[model samples]
Every structure is written in C-alpha cells, then in structure tokens.
Target: MAERRVFITGTAGFIGFHLARLLLAEGFRVHGYDGMTDYYDVRLKQRRHAMLAQSESFTATEARLEDMDTLQRTVEAFRPDIIVHLAAQAGVRYSLEQPRTYIEANIVGTFNVMECARAVPVQHLLMASTSSVYGANEEMPFRETDKADTPLTIYAASKKATEAMGHSYAHIYGLPTTLFRFFTVYGPWGRPDMALFKFTRGILEGTPIDIYNHGDMWRDFTYVDDLVRGIRLLIDAVPPLPEARGGSVPGANVPGDSLSPAAPFRIVNIGNSDRVRLLDFVDAIEAEIGRKAIRNYLPMQAGDVPATWADASLIHALTGFRPATPFREGVARFVAWYRDYYGR
Candidate 1:
C-alpha cells in the first residue's frame, strides 16, 4: 500500500498541531493549512508550524480559510486521501463581541473547505465541532444523538451550522463526513485564551485568575494527546453511506451510535468522559506550580454554560477508543512545558 496523504486545516492551532504531528510520525505525508491569525498569539502558532516543519513529510500553507482559491489550490495539489478541517475563529465570549468573524471564518470558511472537498472528493472529511453546542441542556452527559438546538453563543451556532452544512454535502455529493465534538482539551501548546493556559500564567506571575461562576463549573477536560489519539483512530472509521450498508446502519452492532440514516455522515464526541470541577482543576495547577493563585470569583459570563460532559461511547463503539487522561496528570505535563518554554 502507498503512503496516505492528509490535508489538515488549522495546523498551527492547538489540536491541529498535535494531530498533524501524530499523523506525520505515523508516516503520513501531511499538508497543513493555517491562517496564523493573531486571535491569541501568532508566535505560538509560528512555533508550532516551525516544529512540524522539522518533519520532511510535513508541508504547510499559511492562508486564511476564507481564501477559497488558496484552499482549493492547496487541496488540489496535495491530493489528500483525507482532509481534517479545524480552522475557525474560536471562543465563546469573543463570539459575543465579534459575531461576524465567526460567521466569516466558521460559516463561510467552512463552506469553502466543503467546496474544495467536493471538487476533489477525499475518502473522508473529518471536521471539529464543540461541546458548547450542547448549550442550555441539563443533561448529565451529552450524546451525539442529543438535540443540540440551543446554542448560547455565536461560536456554538457557527459550529452547528458547519455540522449542518457538512451533512448536506454528504447527502448530496456522497461525501463521507464525520463531525467530532470535542470537550475542553488541555495540555502542552494549548491556546493562551483557554482557562488552563490563563490560570497557569496568572499563577506563575502571582496575578489574579478569574474563577467564573464562582468556581462552580465542571468540564470534561481531555488531554491533548489523548484527544488526538481518538482522532487518529477515527480517521480509519469512515462512515459508510446508507446505501453502501444495504439500508442498514453501519454501527448498528453498537448501541447509541450517531450514524446518519440519510447520508454517509456521523457525529462523535471525543472527550475524557470524566467531568472535573473548576476548583479541583485549579488545585492541580497549584500543585504543579508550587504556588497558589489569587482567585477572583465572578458571576458566570454571558454565553457560558455551567457544565459540559460528553457521552463518548459512540466514538468508542466506532473506533474502539476513548480519551482517558486524568486532569491532574495532564495539568502537570502542561505546567512543566510552561516553565521550560518560558524559562521560569
């Protein structure tokens, strides 16, 4: 068999960086496309791209997802067997302030990717969604089949929109599509905007860290490597069209699978399946940093959910894997990287 080629968007972003590295290590020739926006820190994005550049099999294109021509050209030249779309203007609070950015990047940008994929027709198209789509739901653990109709923020809405668009493309064009909803992913090379990164920085600098909802929140904080491992495994678990399965569901052997009946599409949740309290997460950071943070308790901000937990059995059923990294161990690994990277 020939080596597989993968084209991954947002290769300079947190999850994308890790996924591309994992694929490259496994001998996959990868083409990475990233805008390298200054949403958080362009330097961090540059550093991630630089590290991946060390691999001879990794090639990167620096361009925005809204640039349809560039995206289409890059995908055409790469001729990837699989395409993983992860680029977006991400953040719940930021979405409230800049909803148009989310529309352009998440909506229009995703449309551009789908168009390119349609033209080239990859074997599988896997895109990233979010647990935030389960907004306003009081369910203990969100399943892929759960009705995610109440998206609190534009960020979640934009992701939901992409999922809908992906389904249509799969139904109309027979594209094999998988939309994976991720939980709170944290580890080394994490986005500075995320809670873990902000808290670690504030603790190290002896500054105040905002504990939202008075530290009452709970999250299924998945480790970055573990999250990417699930992704790597799911790459091979492509959804089959209903017709291809003789009008039977592909994963009917396993219960609670989110395989679509009308299209070759599925939605899977990639999470740790263990919810950790915000205060306990802080404790893990304090232990790793050897210092206590100045905690600033505040009301829950708008467009924020009190908790997010994922029922990852669907992903496990399909790929025979689930994210299992504990929050403490993942935090320790992230803090060690923080200290070394910043020369603390």
Candidate 2:
C-alpha cells in the first residue's frame, strides 16, 4: 500500500500538534497548515512547528485559514488521502470581544475547507467541534445525539455552524465526514490561555488566579495525548453512506450513535467521561507545584456555563477507545513540562 498522507490544518495549535505527531509516528506523511496567529504566543506555535519539521515526512505552511487562494493551492498540492480541519479562531471568552474574527476564521474559513474536501473527495474528512456547543443544557453528560442549538457565544456558534455545513456537504456530495466535539483538553504544550496554563503561571509568579463562578465549575477535562489517540483512531472509522451500507444499517442499531440517516456524516464527543470540580483541579495544580495559588473568587463570566460533561460512549462504540487520563495525573504532567520548558 502507498503511504497514507494527511492534510491537517492548525498543526501549530495544541491539539493539532499532538495529532500530527501521533500520525507522523505511525508513518503517515503529513502536511500541516497554520496561521501562526497571535491569539496565544506566536513563539510557542513556532516551536511546535519546528519540532514537527524535524520529521522528513512532515511539512507545513504558515498561513491563515481564511486565505482561500493559498489554502486551496496548498491542499491541492498535498493531494492528501485524509483531511482534518482543526484550525479556527478559538476561545469562548475571546469570542465575546472579537466576534468578527470568529465569523471569518470559524465560519468562512471552515466553509472553504469543506469546499476543498468536496473537490478532493478524500476518504474521510474529520473536523473539530466543541462541548461548549452544548450550552444551557441542564443535563449531566452531553450525548452526541443531544440537541446543541443553544450556543451561548460566537465561538460555540461558529463551531455549531460548521457542523451543519459539514452535514450538508456530506448529504449533497456524499462526503464522508466526522465532527468530534471536544471537552476541556489540557496537557503539555497546551495553549497559554487555558485555565491550567494561566493558573500555573499565576501561581509560579505569585499572582492571583481567578476562580470563576466562585469555584462552582466542573469540566470533563481530557488529556491531549488521549484526545489525539481518539482522533487518530477515528480517521479510519469513516461513516458509510446510507445506501452504501446496503440492506441493513452500519451504525443505526448502535445506541447513542449520532450518524445521520440522510448522509455519511456523524458527530462524536471526545472527552473524559469524568467531570472534575474547578476547586479540585486547582488543588491538584497546587499539589504538583508545591505552591498555592492566590485565589480570587468571581462570578461566572458571560457565555460561561457552570459545568460540561460528555457521554463518550459513541466514540467507544466506533473506535473501541475512550479517554481515561485522570485529571490530577494530567495536571501533574503539565506542571512538570511547564517547569522544564520555562526553567521555573
């Protein structure tokens, strides 16, 4: 068999970096595209790209996703067997301030990617969604089959819109698409804006760490490695077209399956099945760093939900895997990497 090639956007981003590394190790030829946005630290993104460049099979282009001409040229040049659209304007809170960026990057940019996928008609097209899309729901664990129409912020709304776009393309073009809704993912090489990085920095710098919602928050925190592994396995579990499955159903009989009866598309939630409290998460960071955070309790910010849990059973059914990293262990590993990376 020829070597499988993957064209993945946002390779310099946290999850993208990990996923690219995993696929490279598995002998997949990967072409990465990233905007190298200043949303976080550009230097951090550069370092990630530099690391991936060490592999001969890994190549990258630094450009924004909204640049359709360049994006189309790059994708056409790569001729990938699979395309994973992971680049977007991230951050739920940031979306409240810069709503237009979300529209350009998340909505317009995603549409461009889907168009490319439709043209190439790859074996599979996997895109990223978020658990934040399950906003305002009073449910304990969010299943893929659950309604995700209550996106509170433009960031969540953008991802939700992309899910719809993907489904439409799948239905019309017979594209095999999978959109995975990720929960709170943290680990080494995480974004500086996430809670773990912010809390660790504040603690080490002797600054105050803001505990949101007065420490009443809960998250289904997933480790980056486990999350990427789920992604790697899911690449091959392409949803079959309804007619292609012939007489019977491929995933219809499976309970909790989010496969659309009209198209070769499905939505899966990738998250740790366990939800941990915000205070307990901070405690774990303190335990790992041997320094206590100067806590400043505050009300939940706008567009913030009190808790998010995922029913990850569908991923398990499709790929025979579930994220199992304990949040405490994940936090400790992150702190260790932070110390080594920053010499703190």
Candidate 3:
C-alpha cells in the first residue's frame, strides 16, 4: 500500500506520541493535533511534540478537541485518509473532581471529530475508548460484546457515550468506524498520574508511593509500542457494512469479535490480555530503581475497579496481532527511560 496521509489527535500525549512516531517511522504523512493541556506537566507533552516535530512527516496543531472550529479546520485542511481520535480528559480519579471537563472534552470534542469524519469521509475512523467502560463487570477477561452499561465514573460514561455516538454516525452516514478499548497502558513517555510513572518517580526519589486497594489491584498493563502496533494493524482492517458482509456483520460467528450488525463499525480491545498484580508491578519498578519503595497502602478510590483484563482475541483475529508485552520487561524499559530523561 502507498503511504497514506493520516490525522491523529493527542499526538502530544502518551499513547498518541507513540502511535504517531510509529506511523511516521512507517513512512506515513501524519498531521497531529493536541491541546497541550497542563493536566499533569506541559513540559512532558511539549517534549513529545518536539520529538515528533523532528520528523519531517509530522505536522502538529496545538489546540483543544473542544474547539470545534479549529478541529474541523485542521481536519478539512489535512484531508487525511484515516483519522485516529485519541485526545480526551483521561483519568478515573480525576474525573471525580471535575466531571464537566469529561463532558466537554470526551463528549463535545468527540462529536466534533465525528462531524469532521462525516464531512471528509475517511476510509477508517478509529477512536480510543477505555477498559473502564466495563465498570461493575466482574467478567474475568472483558469482551467487546460484554454489557458495559454500568459506568462508575463520568470519565467512563463519557467514553461510552462517544462509542454510542460513533455507532449512530456510522449507521447513519456509512462511516467505517472502530472503537478500541484500551486497558492499563504504560511505558516510556507515560502520563505522570499513572501508577507506573508515579511509582518509578517515588521509588527513585525515596518518596512514599500510594498503593491503592492495598496493592490488590490487577491491570492488563499494555506496553506503548505493543499498543501502537495493534493500532497500526487495525487501521488496515476497516469494518465493512452489513450489506457488504452478506446481510450480516462479518465475524458474528467469531467468539470474541464485536462487529456491529447494523453498521460498518466494531469495538476491539487493545491490551496485553494478561493481568498483573499492582504489588508485583511496584516490585518491578523497585527492582529497576535498585531501592524498595516506601509503600503507602490505601483503600480503593471511588470509581476504581479492582482489576481489568482484556479479551484480546477479537483484535488478534482482526489484525493478526496482540499486545503481549510482559509487565516486568515493559516496566524496566520505562524505568530506564525515566532515569535517562530526568538525569537520575
């Protein structure tokens, strides 16, 4: 296939930065959009954008997703073959403090993205969802088809709302859409608020690191590179409309595939599919830092799930790829990057 022009939002963010880098490396002309929010540290986001700017194929726009005019203009000007919408007000706990931001960013912002895609009619419109959507779901390994109606936080609810909105647009406008539910994503350039990053920082600084749920939580910790690889593969596996699939959604017979029957859309899980204990993850970081962390065990915060494990079979079936990075190895890589980046 020839190199395609792609538009990716949140290119300055963690996952977005990694995905854009991977796409650029594969010779794709990428137009990146990010708000450069000061949610954690603007320097980290800026650093990511600067690195991407070094690539000739990367063109970035610093703007918020809530700004419909700017987003629409960027998308119209780029005229991208594929659109990856990853920007959002992310964080389960943070959502509790500011629910309105979730509504504005994830809902209104996602609506604008959908509108742009509808106008331009890209070949594939892929957006990021979260495993938190499976709130209150006790299923060991969460599947795409699982009922995710019980969202515990506004953050998850907003993402779920976006999924519904995307489906409606696909059903009405014939837009080929895919929503990938991400598990606990971690690695180099990860968010400072995430457990892995915080743990690494605290361990190196000899500070106390909070261990939520008494270090009993479990997460399907997906490495950034592995997650990006799964995404790259899925870009080519665009969903087909029901008419094109012989009057039914393709992969209905497939056990884990969540191909929608009414439209050319699907929900795939992009995760490691292996749950790692929170304490074990901390242990990995401590080992890498060569010091035991001052652990501060705490009760589970509101809207927090005890564990999350992805049923990744659907993505593997669709793209012949799966995120298989082990927690220890991925943590070590992140620690190495952390030390080098901070001059520790």
Candidate 4:
C-alpha cells in the first residue's frame, strides 16, 4: 500500500516540527513548507528543520506564505492528501509593535493557502487557530460555540480573520476543513518567545523573569505531543453540514457558524482543559530545574488576556481523546529537554 502524503506549513515551528516528525514516524510522506523567517531565532528554527531532515520521508520547501507563487507550486507538487496550515506571525506582544507583520503573515498568507487548497482539493484542510481569539471573553471554559469577535491583539484579529476566510473558501470550493483552536501550547523544542521557554531560560541564567499581569494570568498549557495527537485524530473527523438543515445553503466552516447544513466544516479545540496560573507554571519549571526564579512582576501588556480555559468536549466527543499529559510531567520533560538541548 502506498503511504499517505501530508503537506504542512510551518514545519520548522515548534508544533509543526513535532507534528511532521510524528507523521514521518507513522510512515507518512511529509512535505514541510516554511518561510524560515527571523521572527524569533532563525537558528532555532533551522535546528528543528535539521532534525526533521534526518527523516527520509520528510521534504521541506523554504517559502513564505505571502509568496503565493511558491506556495501554489509547492502545494501542487506535493499533491497532499491532507493540508495542515500552521504557519503564522505568532506573538501577542510583538503584534502590538508590528501589526503589519500579522496582516501579511496571518491574513495574506492564510489567504494564499486557502487559494492553493482551492486549486488542489484535499481530503481535509486543518488550520491552526489560537485561544487568544477568545479575546476579552470571560467564559471560564470557551467552547466552539463561543463568539470570538473581541480579539485583543492584531495577531488574534488576523487569526480570527483567517477563520472567516477559511469558512468562505470551504463554502465556495466545497472544501472539507477543520479549524483547531489551540490553547497555550508548550513543550520540548518550544518557541523561545513563549512563557515556558522564557521562564526556563531566565531562571537557569539567574536573570529575573518578567512575570506579566502581576503573575495573575491563567493558561491552558497543552503539551506539543498531546496537541499533535489531537490533530492526528481530527484528520478523520471532517466537518459535515448537519443533515437537518435541509441542505439548502452550502456549509461554511466559520468558527461561530457551522452553517453548512451540507458542507464539511467544523471547529474544534485542542487543549489540556486545565487553566494553570502563571505563578503555578513558574513553580513547575522551578521544581524541574531545581532553581528559584527571580520574578519581576509587571502590569499586563496590551492585547494580552488575563486567563484562557478551553472546553474541549467537542474534541473529546469527536476523538475520544484529550490532552492527558499532566502539567508537572510535561514541564519536567520540557525542562529536561531544555537542559540537554542547551547543555545547561
């Protein structure tokens, strides 16, 4: 039997790298698409791609999502059965400083991806969304049914725009699409800009880590492995417009509107379902590193949310799996990997 082929963007990113690696291990031919931008640390991204390059089944294309010609050619050449879009301008704080970066990367880039998918139809198209879309939403456990309009950052706004763009594409092109909104994802080979990696790096270097929001923020930190597992399971759970809608209007994959009475589109959450306080997450890292962090508490930055909790019941209902990695174990594994990776 021939192996399945997957075309994934952001293959050099933390989540993309992990997902591509897992697919390769399962005997899937993986084609990774990345711009390899200097958003954070290009060296770190290159290191991740280097690891994936070791896999015989992995092939990477260096192209920005804004480059539609390259993106279209890469997608056509790969002829992927599944297209997972994960690349984006990520960073809430950075978005405040460079909002245009978010527009080009998240909005325009996503538009190109959808256009490519339209050109070459795939079995399933899964794009990454963020819990930040919840914005100022105070819903304890955010659901797929929640209205995610009040995005706090340009980053979130761009992502929310992509969700809308994807829905329109799905409706017009009859595409089978799934949008997975992820909570605060962290683990081995994580992004340095994220809280976990920053806190770990600072604590180990004896530098005071910036504790934002006066260490009062809450995050549903989902481990990368668990997140990829959720994505893996969701591969088969394509969105189908409910039969009861009379099949009048074509289905759309909009986050708040699963209006396809006929089209295949859905939104799902991939998270741990447990919100951890910022201080508690720091403590977990401290326990693993055997060091205490000198915290510099500060006010919440603009475009930042106070807390995030995911209601992953829909994902559990669909995949019969939830991110089960305990916070302590997950933090320990990340710290251990961090120590070894950096030779600390």
The model with the greatest lDDT is 2
Candidates in order, TM-scores: namely 0.98, 0.98, 0.97, 0.94
* Candidate 2 residue lDDT tens string, 204-319: 99999999999999999999999999999999888989887755555555667888999999999999999899999999999999989999999999999999998999999988
Q: What is candidate 4's lDDT per residue for 1-344, written digit by digit as tens?
A: 88899999999999999999999988999999999999888999999999999988999999899999888988999899999999998988999889999999999999898888888888889999999998989967998887898998889999899888888888777898889999989999999999899999999999999998899888898999999999988887777645424333333223344334545677788989998888998999998889999999999888888899998877777767889788899999999999999999
Those runs of model 1 whose alpha carbons end farther than 4 Å from true positions after fitting are 246-252
How far out, in Å, is residue 236 in model 2? Answer: 0.8
In angstroms, give how far residue 105 of model 4 lies from its true place.
Answer: 0.6
Query: lDDT of each prediction vs. the true structure?
Result: 0.93, 0.94, 0.92, 0.88
lDDT of 3 by residue, 1-344 (tens): 87799999999999999999999999999999999988899999999999999999999899998888998989999999999999999999999999999999999999999999999989999999999999999977999999999999999999999999999999999999999999999999999999888988888888999999898899999999999999999998888887777535555445566879899889999999998888888888888788999999999999999999998999888877888988889988999999899999
The full ranking of all candidates by lDDT, starting with the best, is 2, 1, 3, 4
In order, what is each prediction's RMSD in angstroms?
A: 1.2, 1.1, 1.5, 3.1
Pick by lDDT: 1 or 2, better one = 2
**What lDDT would candidate 4 get against the real structure?**
0.88
